[model samples]
Target chain A: MIYLTLFWTFAKVGLFTIGGGYAMIPLIQQQLIERHGWVTPEQFTDFVGIAESTPGPFAINIATFAGIHVAEQHGLSPLLGSVCSTGGVVLPSLVIILLIAGAFHYAMRHWAVRAALEGAKPVVVGLIGSAAFTLLGHTLLPAGEPFHWAAAGFAVALFALTHWVRIGAVSLILLGGALGLVLRCFGVSL
Target chain B: MGAGAEGQVSLGRRLWALTLTFGKFGGITFGGGYAIVALLEEELVRKKGWLTQDELFNIITIGESTPGPIAVNTATFVGYRLAGVLGGVVATAALVFPAWLVIVVVSGFYLAFRENTWVAAALAGIRVAAIVLIARAFLRMGQGVPRTAVNAAACALAFALVALLGCNALWVVVGGLLFGVLWHGVLPRLRGRRAEGGAR
Candidate 1:
């Protein structure tokens, strides 16, 4: 029963949400935390923070963690829960993509399809831009607090590295983690 | 020995190759959808001869317009093209498998050490790094798009709608699709027809 719920909720999330993993954050939070009472908001936030830092899709990370937590509540092992949840979240994507792919060849050659893609491309760019802005907002602007200057500096430096130097994503993330640990040792609040 | 037997062997090889390729993609790609797309271009187009440049762009557009994460959606499309339904299934599974392991392992460590000041500090830094990575993806995608005035206006409009006006991202995408069809697809045809009539 717990597994079914876990799968169903995430399937719903995957099916309804568009854009990407970040776009699903609010919905996941609302459904899992507020609606389902699976985990506390605090726990969900932790998962989000960690998921953002991890490799792979943010949605999958959150679903895995949430699944483990829910499974623990049902007296099941975390491994079983993780599989159930991850399976649930990805199932919708797998089905949906298969259906779309089946039709992709036929639909792609149409002039209308080309035009629609042209119109949609800029919007996709804008959607990506919005995602960036959201990240900036979350990192730099904590609620009821002044802006974080250090975070801003880190962002600029990292952006420059990404834009110009062509550093790998894994290296950048590891470097940031190391910097964070060093900052902590130095008594910085981070 | 038979031709059919040889075909089966090749089909099996194709499925295995598709699984390996997308599996690697899912393992390394961070940030989210757009970053995955950028990496796919680098790997599938520039390095491998699997997809031509135009096909990559076309498939990416399809992935974006469809529901689900772009990375997973793209994997299914590519895998299906390579090896049919089973290929698609294999690719999607292989892609998510690595991340599933990573997340589960991290969840265990996180649950154990979440209260540590050291962990908190590290996470805070990681949070900022994650944002920068996503920003990088946005910049990468932006580089591909031609910088035209109409595109600029549409971009601004989309940003405002989603960020400020709190509009759904899907509606914004739909609006862009309509704008694109009208401006690039429909309007040009109308103008061409008018010029022909004038000549007559």
Candidate 2:
């Protein structure tokens, strides 16, 4: 049943999300964190970093990793769980794209579909916006947990650095890990 | 008879090649679908000559406007164009397979020591950085959104609905779809009708 839930949850996300992986972050957070208690909000952030740092599609990585983590809680093997979740997520794309390819012109010309997407854009922005705020809340306000002010400040600095300096996302993530390790070595208590 | 047999052999070979090429792209490209597109052009158009530049561009345009992630959608289309349904399935699965394997391995290590305080402390910094990266995504996405009253209202409403009101995000998305139909679809037709009446 948990495996089935994992498949359906990602399948639904894969079906509806547009604009790709970043867009799917909030939905993943919603389904995996808010809806199910698979991982805490803070852990979800870590998973996001992991997903971006690793290769492949953003959503698929999240689905695969999150699926493995959640499935392990039920004493399931990570391998089978990952296959089920990844299969569920990719299934929609494989099926839907094939349908569109079959009737490419007609699908493209449909006005209601276009209008729905136009509507979805702003909503996606809001969803992403909410995700940003949610991440900030988790970082800044980890209730009953020690707030690592220094590390949090460093994160802000990195944000400014990346925006102004044009570093790639993968490099930035690597830099974050390196800095984290260095901070730990120096007894920074991050 | 020889020519027909030779053609069949090449089709099988092309499907295998398609699997390898898309699998490599899926394994390596880090950023997003657009990253895959640039690499696809280099490999399929410039290097392999599997597709012409114009054909790639048309596929890209279709891929972008479609619902699925651009990378997967493009793979499906290219594979289908090259062979058929079987080719499309093979290409899509190959593209996703490598990453799925990698994630499974990484997830094992992560879950094993998830409760370790040392790991948590070390990850604190990355967690902070992750927040920033997400913020960057938000700002980047915001730039593309049209600065219209309807859009702005929708953005604010959606934020409040999900973040403040704790409403289900899915419902917000559904509302946006309906709102879009009313705003972009129905409203325009109504205005045009009103304009025709005024002309009369």
Candidate 3:
């Protein structure tokens, strides 16, 4: 039963999560945490932390791990569990690719098609910008206080280090984590 | 027509070519889409000249708004633009097939070595890298923001509404849609009538 649910949910997520892992955060949060009750907010937060720390795309990793939770609850193996949910999320994008590939070549030379698409682009940009803002707003603040001043300060420093100092991102995350650890050790209440 | 300077290739051949192109990108390209933007812009736009910068930017934006992989969507759009449906299929398959394969392989090994200290250290390094990638995107988006006062205001408002107020993305998207249409379309129409009346 849970496997079935995992399959369907992931399939839905896979179909829609078009702009990559980050874009899927809202939907993933909705389906997995809010709707399903598969994991609590704290557990989901841990899931996200582990997912972020892993090697693959955040979307894929989360889907895989969460699928395991759903399937295993219903007595399924982790491997099968992972595959079932992954299949669901991937199927849409796969179909989209295959379906669109068949006709796009012929449509390339169509003037009206091109014009309509061109017109669409600015609108799409606006939408994307909107979505980006939505994600930033969610992640930027610490509940009500702009996501903790220390974290905010760390974010600023990371930005400066990356852009101005030309440091790599991996370095900044480590630095932030270390900073967080130090604060935690010092009982700074971060 | 411009079949890579080769003779007219079959649909199968074209699809194969696109698959190979994006599949390679999926497997080897790291640091995600924003990092690969320069690479992609170079390979697909500058060197290949498949899309103009504006067109590429449009695809990037659309991918951001939509669900799924930005690379995958861009590949679909570009491939579709180049060759139609076949191109879209080939490109998307190429892009994701690699990620899927890599994930499986990596996961198999990773699950087995869950306690490795080096793996932990490497992950620490990777975490930092990922954060940097996100930051890079922030800067890039900052650069792309329209310089107009209205556009600027909209950005700030959008930020505060979403960030400070915990506004949902769907709402922000709705707001942007309305804002774009009004600012770019309705406002111009209103101004056009005023100019015409003044002339009269």
Best by lDDT: 1
For model 1 the local lDDT of residue B170 reads 67
True contacts kept of 3: 0.16
Each candidate's DockQ score against the native complex? 0.57, 0.36, 0.19
Lowest summed lDDT over 10 consecutive residues: which window, candidate 1 chain B?
B1-10
Per-prediction count of colliding residue pairs?
1, 0, 32
Number of residue pairs clashing in candidate 1, backbone atoms closer than 3 angstroms, sequence gap of 3 or more or interchain: 1
Full-model lDDT for every candidate: 0.76, 0.72, 0.57
Kindly report which residue pairs in candidate 2 clash with one another.
none
Model 3 CA lDDT for position B183? 62
Error of 3 at B98 (Å): 4.2
lDDT per residue, candidate 3, B72-133, as tens digits? 56777777766676677677667655555544555545444545554444443333333444
lDDT of 3 by residue, A62-109 (tens): 677676666666777866777777667755665665455455457647
Where does model 1 sit among the CAPRI classes?
A: medium
Per-residue lDDT over A33-122 for candidate 2, one digit per residue giving the tens place of the 0 to 100 score: 889888999889889877765668777788899888888889987777887788887788788777766776475477775676677777
DockQ score for model 3: 0.19
Our model 3 lands, by Cα RMSD against the true structure, at 7.0
Q: Which segments of candidate 3 are over 4 A away from where they belong? A: A1-6, A15-47, A66-83, A93-190, B1-21, B24-49, B64-72, B106-117, B130-146, B163-166
Instruction: Identify the superior model by DockQ, candidate 2 or candidate 3.
Output: 2
Candidate 2, which CAPRI tier?
A: acceptable
